[model samples]
Target: MNYLISALIITLIIPIWGLLIYFLNKLLYILLSKISSEKVAMTVVNYLTIPGVIHHELSHAALALLTGAIVTEFKPFWPDKTSGSLGHVNFSTRGSLFTRCLQCTFTSTAPVILGTLSSILLFAYAANNTVPFYILVPMIYLIFSIIIHASMSFADVKIMLKGIWALFIAAYIICLYFQIDFLNVIRLHLIAQL
Candidate 1:
């Protein structure tokens, strides 16, 4: 029962954590704008999150290409305060509506998926290996940083909603059903590896 509760908590927190990070970024951006120019605030945010932004845009581009979408514009670090977009990938969707919607949803949500996978690998690696204290600290920091930036921005979510929210929901449900103890599996795997 405790294990089940723990898994439930972990499952709930994953999405909520991403959303909290997204909203926190927005709030910080707004507050910073009051103290300085919007561009400066946005620049600061972008500068601080260069690694995440690069990963985000790369994932977007990769998924876009995989979906056969033409990525017309790709900006890894061009923050736009006016548009409230930290970085963007402009791609044209084609094919039937379902295919277009799936492509759009996948492209927009790739960052979170990839970031989570990266974070999991880092954690698992750290668990499986012995490292010096200093190195371990930085490794832990990197994992946290990846998680912090793993969430899609409001713009990304909006694009996803415009695509096919139902499809995404159904996919999520299917994944949930098959991986009800996903967190526990990760925990167990780490334990075994350690």
Candidate 2:
């Protein structure tokens, strides 16, 4: 059915986009490195993606606090070649095992959630041609920048894996609470598109 196809497309969009961005970023770095020093290439890439880095770090910190975790340190932008990290949020997990797992998973995935929402809103805005050309240009750039850095780091993934089971349960509960029908929603979207 159209709805099932739409649902499949929606589910696969994030991972596909993440992989594409990852490879493109790596290729950009390699090309830049060939043309310049590694350090310079890194610096250029960091500067280009600074906005997303800031958003990503802030999302982590925000979710940490929301989930009852204590954020001990927050760095929005600290490019460390040795660590290969643009920024980091150090949070102390609180609550029981379930709660802690939920906290870790939510905090780790905040960037992707927030970035996707942000991109969707920006795209909606850009779709409206009434916006001024100047504003639209920056909005498009910000959407691109946010999406490129929306993926979780390896360390973040490990942290999330610790609590992914809890996350799934919570997600399912939320869907139930909202009476969400993914297939219905997607089918409606498909109808609208047609």
Candidate topping lDDT:
2
Task: Output the worst ten-in-a-row residue range by lDDT, candidate 1.
Answer: 2-11
lDDT of 2 by residue, 66-180 (tens): 9999999999988787988998999999899989998998898778778888889889877965888899888887887787777777677778778876765665565566655
TM-scores of the models, in the order given: 0.64, 0.77
lDDT of 2 at 184: 80
Off by over 4 Å in 2: 1-24, 31-41, 181-194
In the range 1-194, model 1's lDDT, one tens digit per residue, is 43444444543453455577677767777888999988887666667557777777888899888987789999987877588566778999888787788778778777777878888998999899998899998888777656656787767777766665435454555556665555666789999998
Residue 89 local lDDT, model 1: 83
lDDT of each: 0.72, 0.78
Clashes of 2: 0
